[model samples]
Target chain A: MGVAPRPPAGDEGLSALRRLLLQPEQRRIEELGERLDDPRLRARDVGRVLPEALRLSATESETGESLSEALAPTVETIIHDAVRRDGRRFADALYPVIGPAIRKAMAETLRQMLQSLNEVLEHSFSRQGLMWRLEAWRSGRPFAEVVLLHSLEFRVEQVFLIHRESGILLRHLSAPDVAFEDADLVSAMLTAIQDFMHDSFSSAGRQPLDGIQMGDLTLWVEQGPEAVIAGAIRGTPPEALRGVFRRALEAIHQTQAAALREFHGDPAAFETAEVQHILEGCLQARYRERPRRTSPLLIVLLLALLIGSGYWGFLVLREQQAFEAYRERLDRAPGIVVTQAVADGDGYRIEGLRDPLAVEPRSLLGDAPLPVERLRFRFEPYQALVPAFVLTRARRLLQPPPTVDLTLDGGVLRLRGSAPAAWVEEARRLALALPGVTALDDGALQDPARAELQSLRADLGRQVIHFGVDTPRGEIDTPSLTRLADDLRRLQALAQSLGLTPQVTLVGHSDASGTPARNRALSGQRAQWLRRQLLELGVDPALLAVRAAGSDEPASDAQTPQGRAKNRRVTLDVRLDGAGGETP
Target chain B: MRKKVCLLGAFAVGKTSLVERFVKSLFNARYQTSLGVKIDKKSLVIDDQPLELILWDLAGEDEFVSLRLPYLRGAAGLLLVVDGTRPETLDTALMLHEKALDEVGEVPFVLLINKADLAESWHIDPRDIDRLVARGWSVLETSAKTGHGVEEAFVTLGKEMLGAE
Candidate 1:
């Protein structure tokens, strides 16, 4: 075998070729074998692949579930053991995650409650609420910000600024109505507790006790280099309260640095207003805003007021309209003038002018359902000159006899009924004097059953015996005087034909150019001259009488020369006495 | 002026009874504390100056309960009480005095030998108290049962605390 090694040079090439060909495979196979043989390497390899393997297995649900099922009891036991060993550490570890989860659960619970705020007070959306909202909007702030300023989230009942080294109460401020123990004693006790806790629990005493929670109250301590400020809060405080305390303590440290450092047991050096103000700032509080409950009685009263006002307003409106319609009706009524229609308290005062002949004002309230007692009226009597009312006034004032029918057309009075001569003369005078009567015409006349007497009086009254200007004897109408003398002899013959007594009177009229006394003397001389002429013409002297009617009841318009001449002439007259004298 | 004054003593030294005779305090204040201490208040007008001494009656130092050094912090003065019947209580009070000095640096203090009414069998030698007195310590013999020297002891301590400030 020793001699056989010399023949392996060519075989060395074969070995080299074999090494190149199978070395990688050989190394890999050795690695596999070593991994199987040594548990440490095998475990390392398995550990490297375990995650990937588990991932792949997990994709296949069967192996993943089985693997987890196998691990469940051990994991449970490990967790139980861990919890049993140091539950506080476990709790602290879970704190970060548990807080939000619990908060979310609580939020969900609150959401599920979904209490509807349907019973909110009526004043919430009332005018006052609108005003409040307007104020908030104008200020450009949140409603809650405006409201929560006075609404306290928490109250810091007491604040104790304590000396660091001595634990003496340097300055203290407390909220109103908050009862407390002695501040010095409390300060000492708190410092002792702090020391006790530090000595008992802390490996290093640099960290001070921060807070103590006690049933709706919390004691917060903020430490500074020389002083510690403690706040006793009576409710849940917001996180911003931390910054408040920090800032307050910072201010105190800056301003009261000397007082804090050189503080003795007297505590008088820290009693200045600035330090007190700083401490008072530490006594922060948020006042509570109580939810105001709506009073049922108040609501009822408001409702009653609303309904009562509404009804009263409706009645007022209706009454106003009714009064308007009534006023319109009254205004339209003829001869009624509505001067003032005023609305008084719960009623109307209507003042106007009313013709006595017009319809009543009260009767005009036809369809309006208004209280009769609530209406007032003041009407003054007035005479309306309307045509119908004028006729009525004429009829009332004149009191014309039925036999003498009276008619008025455009203020002209026309009388056309038989009557005695004296009655006819009186009616003519009175009819012309009536209101709104401009003229009178009464020529048609016939005595009842006495045609001759009526014709004789008409013929005699139509004749005119004229006289010269201002003289009785000058330029007399000879033929007219002779005819008037003859008519007077006939009137004496017909006086017995009339049922009533008649008289022929020589009446004289004079021009209105002269004075009444001269005109009356001239008219009487003319009438006496005419009577003497008629008496010389063989007429009965007692049947004719001379009278003077000077410048009155002119025959025509007096402003003309012809009317003046006619007014100066004399005419025959007839009269019937009230007692029928010389009746057949 | 308010001052913090501590009562340091051995067990069964009548420190509480001495404080009760010297001050009016809320009795329930002791039950309110979970710590081994009680608080009382004694107001006095020393030299025409109004002084309020907040008396901290610490629990007696014994085998079962050790003195908590933190309670001595901020103390203006200390009342070192001893039982006249037990000689060892004086040593305990002296030890507490040194402990209090270590916690809160040098302050005024008074040594009170309690139960002096029963001094017929008193175990403390008057020479030891005289030795403490010669070292410039204010010392007094007090009787809680008869209230002898109780008010004077508190007033003396109050005056010292007020003067120290």
Candidate 2:
């Protein structure tokens, strides 16, 4: 296309050619000028940089203010248009933020409410709380309501803001959970009562029936020029509650002055925010907590009582144990029987039979916890057949010396050790006579003179008379025989002194040279000869015995003459005994 | 609309008995003994407008106790009861009317010749009641025992009180 225009590119042609050639460029330049001059074009140019400019401006507060102000309505319009087009989208976009915001606000409110209810929670688990719970059940009310009722010194249940002239309820407020009938009627009755009071009691002036009481309920009326604040209260309301009602009525009269004056059958005028608030304030309750106090004197008294009882119980237990131990001791004591052991009031009574010779019952109480004075003993005297009692009776009757030990075994009384011969004889006589004593065994019992008697018998046994060869049965040495006779006499004296009958045994021996029959005859003759000599020495003939022994049991060797002489000797044996506490 | 209506008459004139069956009572008769008045509520519709009437049944006025005039302070209407067997009760009604007029101003009122169940023994002449009726006083005969004219009397008075307002 430029080549075709180049053919016409001479002075005119060239001018024409120049015009044609410059046409596109000239049009582009003019268009560029127009675009630069046009506000719409400039606007498009600014639109391209607007976002970046705004972003930069935002970093500086001063520039951002103008930019933000410039775009404020547009931004709002765009958002508004967007919401109008799809509100659900906008709502969905905001739900996440709004939900947590609302939740936080609600949680804060709940926290504040819980703080206010802290006092209520404190009383919820208290003793008084349980009582209020019961009352709540009985009265068919809420637990919180019952708690308020009891905790409050006085509760204004319902408040009636009545137009004094019309006796119409202008506004009413009641505590939560208060079930009331028509407040209008109550207000009217209150006015009527006031009127009745004025009519009956007053001659000229007005007399308001400020208070009306019916059982636990009290209707307190506080009168103003145009309104009467009548409060139906439970429990005994303090006098200050009257002041509250008065101030409330005065406040209502002030705020609802024209309304109260022009009040007709309709009560809409008094339902104002101020009037309702004032009436609600009148419907108040005083939550005065009951004081809790613990008396110290009561605690002290209780402690003292506890300790006193404990000590008394301990003493009683100890006494009982002591009594039991004493009873056991008596049960184990021989010759002592406990038939009855009972506690009689503060003392003990013991009744049983006891042997007279046995230990005293009181003496058996060793380190007893119970005082002796607190015990009464009633014992009947009876002979105890127990061996110990029998032995005791034997000792008591026989009067044996300390050397004598009296013991009972299997119902037999045995006396051992040494004692006077006269005492031993008496014990033997009486031991068998005692009850429960079958027999007296004095076999082991020894007399005090028994040693001297045994020594005398030994001396008599040592005496021997020598004989010449083949001299049998007739030879005697006078000096030795005399000594033997003296010993026999001493033995007899000791045996008699010891309350014993003495017996003398004479033994004879012969030499081995003699024949057996001859030796036996010869030895017997020698023993008879010795026994005769003993009888002459004052031993009784009935107490003498002779025994013949052959050389088969020799004292010495038979081959030597000296040994043979020892073998042919005469010997004596002695024994003395009598059955009593001790046989001698 | 709530209206306070008062019943005023002499002693034993059936002032309280006339309204006993016609109204809902929140207070017992003990208030009448102590406070000299008992309040009862009568909710009714007149001209399609719900009207609550707080009926203050003031104790009967006699030698012992007079009409408690302050009870009529805000009364929009009155039910002046009269025992028809006793002509003297009509005079007591008239006297109570005078006292009520002075206390509560001129308000809508109805004259009830009560004990009409014993009409044969009625001593109150109809000429006298008719004369009062001609004087612009609303009058009706009512027997509380028979429940006759009892409902109409309160309705008429409730209508008059609403109409007056």
Candidate 3:
């Protein structure tokens, strides 16, 4: 009780914190390995090795060891050569510029890798499993989000305080901070010492004196030798400190940079926003490296792939159409003709036959004499079901009917009563030749009396009108005001020839050179000019009306010379007086 | 600082046409309706100082009326157009001028009487033109179809835009 308790040995606690800090390198390597494992990573060469190399070199440098000690001799040589080329004494020396480069390279590599990985993963995780896994991961509680909250504030006092503790600062800080902060010259040495201690403890992987020991803190706490170093880095001279801090970042972040490659997949599709977002998000989360989904570039690349696939699908559809056409041709011989038998030499003239000699006989015509001369003919199986007859003349045989009618209501053939059995058979054959002719109808076999009466009525009303009148001046006529009026009247008569009576109205048109108002006046005068001529022609004045359409309605286009000439014409319309009346 | 001038007027009164004429010195016969405001720039020497003029050719449609005032931000002058043959354009021109004043405070504006090449059929009176001039507004008759008085109109406005009286 009497012995005074010595303050708990402070050096031992500091040493233990140092060990804890060093352990992060190993943890970082493991984290990096997970990121590289994604199958899709394309920069396999770069992504897999760079991050691990950076971590190993940085760790070795912290302990004042060679890269060879942390990794195999082969990997050590690579890191050694890279640092040597960078003109740095050690791998840790290249941290600043190289850290960012490594990170970017890893990101690119990982993005490329994802494309191949997706195929394997898609199959591995059944569709449902993949969907559910994505949902679950998204739904999972977010990791303790560590955001690098940057707040720039002007504090003259903070600078003054460091200046007042000038000697203490320089002894512990670096030369850059001394120069940057404009501290007293003597303070440079003191600040330099503090800077050394800070970097040394961090480099040694020791938790800063002020660092939080708790696993999780409700509020983020940035306190420790690390924080002090950060402050020093901020306060240091922009010129000198820039290099030092940059180097420190490179050293600390090398492993992360190398691991970045695991995330890259499809380097070409890496320009999308999603890929950028993923890289930014992972970096912000301080993930040892990003996963494929976290990479925004990969997402963009995936979108591009989908779009490419859609375009390929369109091409596939076009190919299918071409194939369908090709398939259809292959199933049938080219240019084959089929026809009903009639009595004109071969009895049936070929209709629209590319080659009349390519016709083939059907199975139903078993043992029937195969015609040596392959006269093109349409043989329909349904036509065979209907009775067929050979219509012959003693002297000259007429051409075959274009089509043999086989009208069927359901699955049965209705024939005219007068139809001979041969005609019924021909109808069945014709019906069968055409697709969708499942059944046949030989209406000729319905009733001979009914057939005779129907035929008579059909022939009774069939008539065609042929015109034989000739106009006086068959020479070409320009569409002047006079000729336009005469044509209008002539067209009206043409409509009458087709059994339609028209309400003839004469309209006049003109060119655009004249003033609109004057043009309107001129149009009316032209229309009046036509009205007088029509009256002189002894045309019914009561039936004829005239109006100035102006330049609104052009028969031909007005932009071109020919179009304008055609446009300057009168159009005649025939209006049937009754609803059911016919107009030609 | 460049002065932002908005060319606001009725549908075919030639806002784009006028701007195109001033900027490119070429006229296009085929006219298509402008969808939104287009920005064009030109600089003029006034009193030995280079004054940059940013002309915002505002689309002239009834639907665009709501968006007109926003484009007028930081504006120094407004070019209001009226079809010379259509005396009806005078009312539309006056309405636009009044809105510029009400929304953007006091700003100098010039009235462009466009389509002057067409024969005067709507009975535009000399006194009506003078009335616009009397109300502190400058007026110029121009034809976007031709180059008549087009340059003079912009040159006069350029003086007012550069704050050189």
Candidate 4:
């Protein structure tokens, strides 16, 4: 590279050069550069110190008055631009923290609203609640407050005054009945929670923690500049009480600010009578009249309802048992088949198939009688081959004499009592032929003809024929002969009608004065003569038979004249084919 | 006196397990992530003073999500837990500690390296622990599984909260 010659340096030459180089504007520019070189002046450079300046301004603005007002437009513009650019990122960043918070807040608010609505509905519909509403209307108080008064039972179990800075317990007041330990610990915890809340969420103009809920208890807090007043309340308290707590805290702060601000660990200074009175005012225990302990009338009505229902159930059970027993009995009855048994109201509808010849169903209930009117029977006639039904049919078909009795043993039919021969024969045939009859027992049955024959024999025994002379050759008396002929004819007819051939015999008898042989000969002649007389009287010859007895059988005695006269006659004898003769 | 203490850590660092071991002396092998803040109370006596410690076991911080500030509002002390088997958990604990400091100011705290019973699988460097100790940070090796140092960590933080040490 080529080098140029250097100009001469002199004060006059330097002045001219300075004048030529430094115009008024150039001097101003140099002065400005020097000023810019100054640390204090360079501190104002937009690129070098603008960020720090802005940061300091931001911090100052935060501590200064109305930080939000000052930064609102800028912050809003930045937020709007960010949201426009990437709203999803912003939402995602906020979701985890804010989503649950919003959800919980909405849920809690809805739940509380629903609970209040339910309470209102429950109270408004209740009888005593109606009175409470009316009282609220009359007193011109809010319905919600009236409801709180009527239904809410609240107690300020304990009240604590805690130092804000040190978390020291300044004062504690509790209801006499409430027992708790570590009041100082509770106060410290409360203060710690408040402090935590302030530090964790250190945003501008953030409110202190207002309350903490644990099951049925709530810790209501009112934070003052120097102290925090907390009330542990059980059950829901009226909203107006929050104002009372606030007012109490304000009063304490106003009256004891110096003491509270200077308070160290000791709480003795706060235990003064005034502080005690102030804390005592926060302690409250009040119960709404325990909602009229279950009305006596309601209890009585419930008891009555229960008793009535029980009795009704018992009656139904008894009726069912009785009906079951009755149904069983009817089912067991012969020739009766129960189809259905239904209870209708107080009555039973019984449906069954029954043989008319069977025993009555009503009669079966003799031992355990049922109300006849309450039982309705729907029976269909059916032909049953049971023994009892068979017997009934047999009796109806045969219609034996009244003296005859019929009995059935298992499948066997037994006949007893006297009856006509024809009736007995017919009954035996019918009973044996009956559907269910396995056998017929006619052993006890009697033929009426036999009885008639016995009576005829007795009449014959009382009758006697008399001869005028004692000799067998003597003629019979006309009147006596006529009576003998009539008697013989009647005996022949009676025996023949009884399906038996009868033989009429005339026996010859004499007193003890005659020889046995002569008596026997005379008896033979008399029997032959009587046979001929009977033959002449239209009596069948085959029906007549002679028996000669030489006084071997005497009707009475042969010694007395009257007895001899009764014995010295030719006796009449009547014998059936299967019956032996009886001499008279 | 009652003190509200918060347990802060990354996920699966045994913060809840530590609280369980300290409060109930019980430990379970199963891991269950807490979704939100869980509050538990333990009564203890330290230095002849009865104190009720209300433990706030907060859900572990997820990379995509931050903790709710309200949950740590009333805390008087903090327990920063790290899983010894995971060295990255120490960084997470340090980050949470920074957040706690910013939100709650200076409060009593203890740094717990959890799962000491599993020292064979320890990943936390002793140098990192020494650095914390050199920085005057309270550090303890704890095991929620074997209940080692869990009570001590809580008691130490409790004592500090009560200004006893």
Candidate 5:
């Protein structure tokens, strides 16, 4: 609103000249001012410039400091301001996402704890573990350490260090026995698998694979910022081995930091002997062998020895019993004098004296027959005049006739033969009264007198004489009479030798033509004539007797003349007193 | 010193006969196929070094079964035998060689073309032998019957194994 002051002529001239020179610059400033004054245009300008600044900041966060460290304080302040404004909403929004995740983490931790506990229990109760415990006690070592050493026997067969970005094998260490010809291939494969897992399953924030197990070998992988370490373990390693891997990775990062961070494809930078020495410290190959137990073969041998000895004892007892029974049998035999009866090997040897007349000792075993091979006899002859010997002597002294026989058995004497009556009576009385004789069996013995009588009757029957006619006085032929007398005398002499009284009887018979009274009287007269003839032959009167027979006692047919002459003959009958006696 | 060697081949390739010819110098006219594995030991001195070779004769590979890998655990060398009369046995022998390399890493080995006694009826082609030779594989023509190149095959494998160690 106020009026302007006028310039000097010289200043006015300078101002005109300056105004003409700054005219284009003033117009450009005016245009820029107008565009900056529009809100949409200003927003477009900011949009164009903000991305470069954000990218620069992101690059600084990634390459310089970690993202967590760069954003931690800012995020903390923002979270505090948000919580103050809407704590309930913040909690509600966070619960659905974080609750399950926290629970899953807790569950995984508890599951790992329980798994470790179960493994400890299984190892403590196992047979191999028990032996290990015993060995721990014997060696004065801690039980837990022994269990760790025995149950988790581990051998670090091979170890590899590979660059994470290029999948190049940085360093390799292997046991002398383990061969790793394709270690680079294995590293590449491992890196490829890790990339595949990261692509397939890695979420916003998750770790890559850490381990892989195949049969008895386990590959333990530890990843760092630029390098990865993989170890091939032969057996089950303790969980504490992870610490060793971490320590190795940390050492590699400290010593080979520049090589790991700015690594190309060259593995020579990491192949230093110092790195190998540091990695070798992680290797642990500890093994605890179980103690040997008692063998079962020794126990079986002891039992077999016991059984064998018992069987031998039983055989000895049986042999002793057999010998005892043999001794008892020898004591009961009377005729044998046993001098020696002993067991010799499998049999018995017996030496004694025996009597020839007595029963043999071998015969005494009738009730109990022993095996012939098990018995041996050696005896000498002896004269033991026992009861049997006395009986035999008595039989010989009797001396009976040739028809007599004697038998002595079981103390009984028997006579079984034919003899004279006197001889039989003598044998019976002598055998019954003999010493050592229990009984006499003479019932079978017979006298020969009865047999002699039968012979005498046959001789007298052939010498019968008959009258020639029916006359009371028959003709006595001298030669015929002499023969008849000789036969009668022989019969009488047989009876006398038999110690018997002989008696002769004469009988007369008549024909039917004569009268009964006259025939009877004539037969009586013929009997008296025959009796006198026998008396004249020097026979005893007591042995001569006569009998008369009438026509009722016919000798032949009575109607003929020869019959009448035969009927008138005199018949002689002889009898011996003792010889004709009943057999005694 | 002692070394363990494994014998691998197809069925009826006469792996046992090769061992008998080398160890006992005896041959049986009758063929008795082996079951599972049989172990035999032979002692020899090569270059003034005493060596005890433990030979593990594994069962031949059939259509229904294959060789067990556990039998090749600590082997230092391998003897791959193929019947000269059967060309298919060479395929089995090569396959087994691959498997053995996978399990035991790189080890010295020798390939034997067995039954050279019947050369007229041989089915193995000369080109196959030439191909193996070109690939730096040692191939020997041996016969358990006529006792040809039997000792050289074992001795060569022994020397290579000793040198490798």
Candidate 6:
């Protein structure tokens, strides 16, 4: 230090540290530059830092050079870079090649594992006594060439082989593509190889790349498709070998970028550039062609069809509206019109009156006159709400029989009525008839007895008889009612029941009371009473026509009490009376 | 129609021998384990309809007692085999029946006292076989070696398998 004022440790120290920490190579170059500038300083620096293991010994050489002199700069730079800039730039420049190399190494490892699995399966299958060789073996026929390839994007690279012609002793060598370093490319290549060769073992003859042969070679290999390039060679031809390499290289290049872009998200410069040009070309070509179409005939035909369908639909809709309107008018207008009402010597008679109010207003308002469709009317005898089996021939023994809305408790049926005297006998019979009905209490309306029967007879054919009976006692004692119910059960069992059938009528009668003002009301009550009693018996009330003639036209003298009693009783009088009036 | 029922057993326990006797009324000296399950179908007139009875015959393996369990599913009836001469084969037959019960649940079964032509030297007692019958198992004594009782085993199975009263 005293002899030389040794250069500032600051610059020297920094350079040495930089060499050790960052670019050691650059640091070594700098050290070399310093030594060339001054020989004495370079020799002193080498002597201070040289390790004992690298120390110059007395070992002689023809052109002797010290070990420290030879590696001294390199050591100096390594120390200097430890203090200089970080070395990421150098690493960045090296990565593209390194990354692919690593990926390729990993894919090769995986391919080897898959090949081992296939070998194991083949050995197992052959040992199972299932597979038999189908082709004959000639004395010198080359063994079948089994080439296992690692693939990428349908591009294959040979990775393994087994040859039958070479016997079991021929040594096989592996020559992997050094440039192929993509894992995704390898996977695609494998898939394509498997798909191509799955059923290859079963082929009968050799084709290009389908089989292998001896020195008079019949080796089939896929070389860029068309030039199957089938040829015999005594040994491997240099040109043929070169051609194989070229085709394989092309396949590798094709699948490499494609598989990378597809699987690893790598973009190709050429692909990006050509894509837009191809798209523009397609668009320009399409514009020049301008797809020629049919004359306006298609549009005209379409419009015609649409309009025709619409017109047909409109006609259907209008017809449907007309039918719906006709139905509405029919429902709104009563089927029969009453034109006149007259009270004559026989009874109060009425005439049919047709009114225009019932017609739809739309028809009247429309400009054109529409034809009216006439209505057809039919009358059928009314059917009972309840079946006949529950009643049977049990109406004769009732005492204070049940009436409408009566509640039964135990053996007692309760009736609440204020009907006239003509209806009393009929009411009594009805109350006694129903099964489970033993007694009755009249609490509501009473039946019209003998007093008002005459007016009821006049309106009988006009108003339908709708009758109902109550079983208030809740228990039946009558034999006929039990027998009827039994018969109904048997009919259900034997399929003998009348299902939804219509029947004829049996008209029943009751006498009338005097005094015209009260007679009409009393007569209506008597007819209602008889209808209820008939319903209580097995005879369906729907199949019965009951009418009352009040004492206005009594069957016997009203002055005698015995005549009133006979007239007040219910009597059966059958009739076939289906007319254009009320349905009974 | 001929109602076919298979007799399955261990090697030399007379499965093929029994089938030969039943089909042809003759003894078969040679025997082999069936390679795979075989099917035989026969028809029986029930309520005037020709009802088909299909029987599946399985190969005999040492592990067959275990493998036959899954094949017993949907089987109408089973005919288990035991060698009357050697008592050990009876255990294999019992194992098969128990496995069928475990997998198929109480299917109707018949046990065969097979090779009855050699029954004079048989070691298994009659009382043990009776115990099985008492527990609702059907027992039939057959001689596949002599064609004795082979027809009766199948005819009895045919009558019982169809629910024919």
Q: Tell how far residue A557 is off in model 1, in angstroms.
A: 73
DockQ of each: 0.27, 0.53, 0.01, 0.02, 0.01, 0.01
Better DockQ candidate (2, 5): 2
Q: TM-score of predicted model 1?
A: 0.42
Error of 2 at B7 (Å): 1.1
Task: List iRMS for all predictions.
Answer: 2.2, 1.3, 28.9, 7.1, 18.2, 27.1
The better-scoring model by lDDT among 2 and 3 is 2
* Stretches > 4 Å off in candidate 5: A1-351, A356-394, A408-410, A433-436, A454-463, A471-501, A515-529, A575-584, B1-165
In order, what fnat does every candidate score?
Answer: 0.43, 0.93, 0.00, 0.00, 0.00, 0.00
lDDT of 4 by residue, A245-322 (tens): 987897798667788776533466786887888788888767665533444444565588799999988878876887
- Cα lDDT tens digits for candidate 3, A123-172: 33556435545554686722111111112111111121111111111112
Worst 10 residues of 5 chain A by lDDT: A290-299
Candidate 4 chain A: 10-residue stretch with minimal lDDT: A61-70
TM-score (chain B only), all candidates: 0.94, 0.96, 0.83, 0.89, 0.91, 0.75
TM-score of chain A, every prediction, order shown: 0.31, 0.32, 0.17, 0.40, 0.32, 0.17
Indicate the TM-score of model 5: 0.26
lDDT of 6: 0.44
List runs of model 6 lying over 4 Å from the truth: A1-584, B1-6, B21-34, B42-51, B63-68
- Among all candidates shown, the one with the greatest TM-score: 2
Superposition error at A536 for model 6 (Å): 99
Which is the better candidate, 2 or 4, if ranked by TM-score? 2
Tell me the whole-model lDDT of each prediction, alpha carbons only.
0.79, 0.80, 0.47, 0.74, 0.74, 0.44
DockQ of candidate 6 (2 decimals)? 0.01
Every model's TM-score: 0.42, 0.45, 0.23, 0.35, 0.26, 0.21
Better of 1 and 4 by TM-score: 1
